[model samples]
Target: MYTIKYRVPESARSGQSARSEEKWYHVSILTQYTCTSTGASNKKRLHRKQYCIATTKSSQLENLRSEFGLPVVMDPIGNGNCQFAAVSYHLRQYGIHRSEETLRQEVVTFLRQTPVLGNRICGANWWTSILKQPRNNLSRMSTEYEYGDQITLQAMSQLNNMQILIVSTRNSATTLISPDGSSCLSSRYPLIILGHYPEGAGEHYVALGYKRHALERIVDKSAQVTWETDPPTSDDDLNVGGDDLSAGGDNLSAGGDDLNAGGDNLSAGGDDLSAGDDDLSAGGDDLNAGGDDLSAGGDDLNAGGDDLSAGGDDLNAGGDYLSAGGDDLSAGGDDLNAGGDDLSAGGDELSAGGDDLNAGGDDLSAGGDDLNAGGDDLSAGGDDLSAGGDDLNAGNYDLSAGGDDLNADGDDLNACDLGSPNTSDITRLREMVQFKRNRKHVHQNRHVILPREIWCIIVDIVLKLSPLSRYSLQRVNRMFRDLVGKTPPPRLYLCPSRFGDVTVSPISVRKIIALSGSGSGLVQAIRQLIRHSSWVNAWLFLRLATLCGWYTVEGIWYRRKRRN
Candidate 1:
């Protein structure tokens, strides 16, 4: 039904950015066809030309280089652990070198601890299924490993406080996961760029390294743009527009000379000249002419005083003549003068002039008279208003205005003028209003009314869910800092040894317990233990515990108790 053709780059140089070349493709489709019963068909083909870079590994790699300034892509072994390996490689740059397995364990632990996020990522039964196996065994099972998706990457981002950039080679699309799972594009967190390539089996991930300064500049610019063009909220629509207009007006006012030049041309031809004639007619002609002359003369006396004065007098006289002519035309004064005796004898023309003056005054005051009439109606409707209020207070009663029964067939007119309420009803209404005010005050200050014990319990639950969140709690307030300090640390456990594994000995356990009383002593003990033991055993027991999870004094105590 369709055929597609792609044009390769003109100069296909290895390691060169494909973005520099113009790329396009042609797609031909059979849009229409006519078929005959005689086994023959006539078809019409539609050809479409599209300008776009081909979605291939080479092109994507080139795009990454061009956009991110030649990031170094470190290919990890594609043995189903590529995602974790890539993450581990990137972490090494930040002085947080971790083995792939350790990283995987950490990811699994974090996902397990956060049930809401875990259930969303996998399924509600994900943890239940994994529970059948030992935690350590589950981490070691290669078949259990899942291909890193956006949700998993987001989990890792939140856990490590690191931002991840996933650039897909199969398509010209990139996904950036921020530390807080928000749309915020800027963060001080270390950025880890992971290149994703589609394989026959599945997708593979590789770490990408770039100049930190360039990345920082790009992030800062993006943040600046985001802040400058923030999405408008409800109030922002009116407030922001008003603020922007005020700012623009201020800027225009700052260049007052230039604005004044433009204003001078506009006022001289438009407002000043045209408005003078209109004002002269609207006002009594004499006063308007004198005002206009004085205003004009004050501004331009030195330039042309005599001409302005002469022009003012001539205009004033002409304005008075025009005013007299307008009155005569409106009232037929000339006709009345010519037929004076006849008009007086009839009395009709004199009455007609009076009627015309009355009509003009009525037309001018029509709107004001209507508004005053509406006010009078409103004042008369107040008794009906009290009847409606009484109905509302009666709970289930139907409205009956003016104490007339609404249910009565011929009582409609009587119901519209309910006079007033009694003293008891007024007192009850006041009490109801006061009760609502008291309830509102209670609800408004509910947080402040919470007991200290309740707050402590809430803090304990939070710390239990996330031990590292203690640092965040410390920054909340002095009271919270003290509470978090008083709370004991979460219990930790060493990884359960597999069957036939002989890694950790009792003597080594005692040495760790005795030395791990302080932070410095704990580091010294780990260093000495690693130095003496085989790399494999040391990695499994000490390094993995330190990297993937905490090794607690309780764990050491448990080991000692079990041996005894």
Candidate 2:
């Protein structure tokens, strides 16, 4: 078993930031709760397969009792990696510790050379296989089940120079096997065990880093034995180091007259010197090299004959010089011009007239966007007009006038210009045409001429019915009879002797008559049939009835007329 420093925030006074305080705890693969002396009711526990978990709660140092609270087990919330955590905890117990990142790097380094481990790293299968053998030979290996104690022992043995061995079954023990073929019993120390229990199968591994004696002795108090390793003595073994120079100290030297005491001027000899005004002439010049003129512009004497004028302007010598004393013109360089209130002539010329002749060069121009010639002596008579330029003037022309006659329309229109029309006019125009058109009148009363085949079908249906139905269709109106006049109605003779024969009666008429009544019932039944049939069928039935009635009347009339 091993111990690691778990840091918790020390609760601060009101309105203060929390400070962190370190607490040493016996950490391993085994499930345990975190105990505090403040109250066991609020102390939370960690379950199996979890070595390090952070809590937001700021736990004070007072909550930990070295005897009972430090190694309290908490509820487990993680899945798998129990064996890895336990082995890691065991290493930490022996003063050799690796962080999670370092552990991952070591595993990757070990797996890279082993071709039989395939491309994957740190999965369940690879861990299981490595735990079982812990040797370089990875041929025909199986990484199926959870790693047992033997596999973990083998893996730990192969990991470092330290020898590790596991005791399984009835007397499960841990032994620190050494390199010199010597073994020491480590059962007193908490051992990481992998086993199945009554609660579940496929059991996970658990680690208890501290020894049994240490665990018992430090029961109620926080564990505080230093778990850090000392630094190695050899400088060659270190990756970084400091030089011989110490920090926070200056190392400088000054020699001879180069070192000034404390004044602005360097005065090494113990002579009184005036070091004010950033000048050393009083101390260095005993012969009065600057003389009494030093108090009044003495440096101007050695300034290449530069004058100290009252205006403080430098005298112009040559090369585009502007005379600062007066406005004296020079004539050598490109900008050799005199400076004054107004420059009449240099590279360009200028002239001004008194009355209204604002002339600069040779021409008195009658030109501008708004020209004004009160005397009307404008000479430029006919020139094409450019924008904003003066108009051409002829004899007795009022070209210099600035009034309504010169008001050229400034309302220039572009391609997308919209005219300023009145809002009321636009509204009235929209109201004159704004409405939905009446489409229902045209749709409701439209003429639709049907096809010839439909009319022929109506007549054909009228021809296939019995005489009684034909007479009933004729009673509908004259128009229906004219429509069915193309086809004659079917003759349906009712004879009780030939009732079952096909020629005696039509099936439709026979069924209607049979289903109805015989004798006087036939009349009302036939009338019902006329009402029930379609227009075409009733027309055909009426025609058939007319034929049958005519035959009977003709036979009776012929016999009576012959007897008379």
Candidate 3:
């Protein structure tokens, strides 16, 4: 028998008390073990509070509020229990695809598709099959989960401990499931369309984010821009996008817009300079656009490769307007540019297969709606797999929309870019923040504390930044002393400087701002920033000729102050 236990951080609790920072009883995960059953063997207990229709339940919950001090109290019952299949699954590790995200997204996709497996087993049960284990070669961390094992049946039998928030159900007419066998997820996940069931073949699980037998879409010519760049970054992302579309709402997207295969350590998206190399590498594989308008999208500029990214040996590294709107939209479809990266499209409505494959061979294009069964897609978010379509046996890079039969190649892996500062980027951010925090601990108060030499290198990395973000980072620690003036980065002198550019002054700042805000949309954007800024009161006082009485007096006063 095996088990998995996780203590939710106190920081994760939703209660008003310190509970927020102390969540211990997180989800119970049965990892590490997978057993087959002929008769009862290695029995285990599963526990969690269950809720049912009852007002008295709230009172009971409130009473226990002091017992655990949890914010959202369980009602009616406390600690409901259930059982599972006799086996723990092949709890062994298998070298999954290079990117860990592939495995992560795969598991998430499977979970999202068939979220619940509720069936009950009895006092006695037996089985002899342990089909696909999580582990292939054999190691820990790889186990298998069977649909209806007597163990799971028995587990579900303890009604008081289990709760199935049914995303979908079988035999809905009869509310409660009371079979001592298997009740595979009966409904279809979003975008997935399953055929009718055979007499008694039980439920078949699929990590399908795309609908089955869905019709291929035909897009218009105008939308078919050969390939361009897009650079739309939000000044504040967390606060801009729609609230309901967050991780909580529509909790189950086609299961992905993101995927990660194990191994290749997707720590970085760059080809020559993978993010894994230097957490601070500037070699951008996946272009950062902030979803802004055409400044620079993921369309990795290569000599030729088309479809997803232009060129690069990473996934989801190209395309200008990839959206996670639908699995149909190209997400990370440009990562493996086999053409040279991975470019697997397979989004809904927007099915444009393998166009930007870094093929430098041809101006690779998935031609709008060019339906190639399992072909690459130049479209979709989290779908970039820039490589040219390799053989299915060899892990094909890009697989555009499926066919009328809707059956994804069993072994294929489709990656989805995890949004901004991708997972690896997040790790980098955390590292930077920690570095600053640590520097503070070592260097307390002093007239001038010299940040470690390493910090000097770190600060230099960000010198190109505008005062806006730089100012924010400076306040992070006393280590920022040498950054601005004191210990000016020697690299500052290395920056491209010219004698003729001595004109760059506060007035130049105003002119640049004004010029950018003129006739073009670029100028308007700057104006918007200035108008909305409630912080800096600084502005250029453009003094025109004194018009009349008031103007003449104001001009005279301005001249006095200027002279002083």
Candidate 4:
């Protein structure tokens, strides 16, 4: 048997004083025992104790109000269709009044049409089960009673092209599902806010409404919260204390020292004992040992030990060794040793038992021979040798002794080397330079080029001539070819050759010219050609024209005869 304890606040309990302290309650749970083959019993028990706080529905509603700024919650019918009912009621506020049954049917239809999206939003098994059916009226009617969840809300958001904010009363937090999977809510689309409240028997959803500017403030807060916090986990245990901690302050530390360390550590000394100031001795002198030890002294004795001896000196044993003493032994101010037999004396003196050693104030000598120590000659066994000076010589031979000698020798060598220039090369170079200078000016200037409009007019006149002439004109130039190609061919009127033999005719040349000028020449020509093209029509036309002409002539001749 195991026992668990809970402390319920007096304000949270019914019919209790609001200012009263909390009271503890105990509950017991029995463990199951299984018998093994050896006749021994093993007891199965829970490893860790889990505590939960249950709030009243009114308190939960108040939390939803404070967090989401939704003071009004319209409860829907809890007939397993509360999700759709809540969504329908929310849409009704925006003048899109849809019934719960209509929204359910729309969701089903959307899922059926887009199976891929349905499978992604809802699980594959759920989608496959929805697809499989005697999908008749009976299956659909059965689905109408099925409860909806976040999957249904996602489908509704995508189907209606809107955003859904699920203000959960359990956690006092808002969950925003956008069509584009972003943290922001698109202002162009309507926002549907739904409240999820826990009921005694089951969970129910209600439509929530906000005040005038409360919606914008809540949305901005939600976006800020979404970015500032880690994504909530799926486990109920992990999400349990999130609301409690977030409601406290901006960070975990703001929950006070109790929740900061006691909640997770559960020790008496808290985090102070584990890794605080006391554990590492960071607040005291334990690590440093003492003040005067290990680099604590004023003169940095470990690095630069100033006074290792009695007289505030350095590395000295006898008479002020390695100090600023005059005429001291090893390293002193004036002399290296007494008796003037110093190994390295400061002033001018003999050294290494010679007149001068390595380098004297005035001269330097090795083996009683003066080296190049001053402004004088250096000799090795009687010969004056100079390595570098105004004059330099080696073994009585001058080698680049003077700067003027080098310059004069170079000038004489140049005078003996070269002769003259080539005249033909000079002439060719001058010609090349002149050709490059005149290249930009080499272009022909034409003074007589006709304008494009004049050329177009001339081409138009030529096109009105015979077909053979138009064809010959097209072969003139590229411009003429293009212009003739662009211009439409002149209308041709063909009539019977016999029609031309008739001297007088119904249609005269002046009539044809008048029709062409009126832009109906094509129609009139076609009509006349059709009238006189066949043999019968041509013969009839000819007979008519000749009879008319002959009658007129006879009338004139008869009048003349009568007068005579």
For residue 81, model 1's alpha carbon misses the true position, in angstroms, by: 1.3
For model 1, how does the per-residue alpha-carbon lDDT over 1-564 read when each residue is reduced to its tens digit?
A: 445443344555699755444333334321221123122321211111123342344765655454444374666655567788688766655545455555666666766666544224544433443434545433554232456555467667766556676655533345567644544433233457777765562477877765445444444444322211333333323221012121111222221222233211111211112222233221223323212533432221112112212223322222222112122212222122211111111211222212211111111111111111111111111111123222322222223333533221111323332333322243333334334445555666786755544566688788766555675788889878866764543333333441222235322444334434435544454444334443122222322223223442221212223564
Cα RMSD of all models vs. native, in order, equals 28.2, 41.5, 32.3, 38.3
**Ranking of candidates on TM-score, top first:** 4, 1, 2, 3
- Alpha carbon deviation, residue 183, candidate 2 (Å): 4.3
Local error of candidate 4 at residue 127 (angstroms):
3.7
Provide backbone clash counts, one per model: 3, 44, 140, 0
lDDT, residue 447, model 1: 69
Tens-place lDDT digits, model 2, residues 110-143: 4444333321243244445443453442322223
lDDT of each: 0.41, 0.32, 0.26, 0.42
The residue-by-residue lDDT of candidate 4 on 156-252, one tens digit each, is 7766545677766544356777654555543333556777765562577777774545554554555322422432233221212111222112232
lDDT of 3: 0.26
Candidate 2 has a TM-score of 0.18
In model 3, the runs with Cα more than 4 Å from the true position are 1-55, 73-309, 312-564
Among residues 3 or more apart in sequence or in different chains, the pairs in candidate 1 whose N, CA or C atoms overlap within 3 Å are 401-415, 402-417, 402-418
| Model 3 residue 437 CA deviation in Å | 59
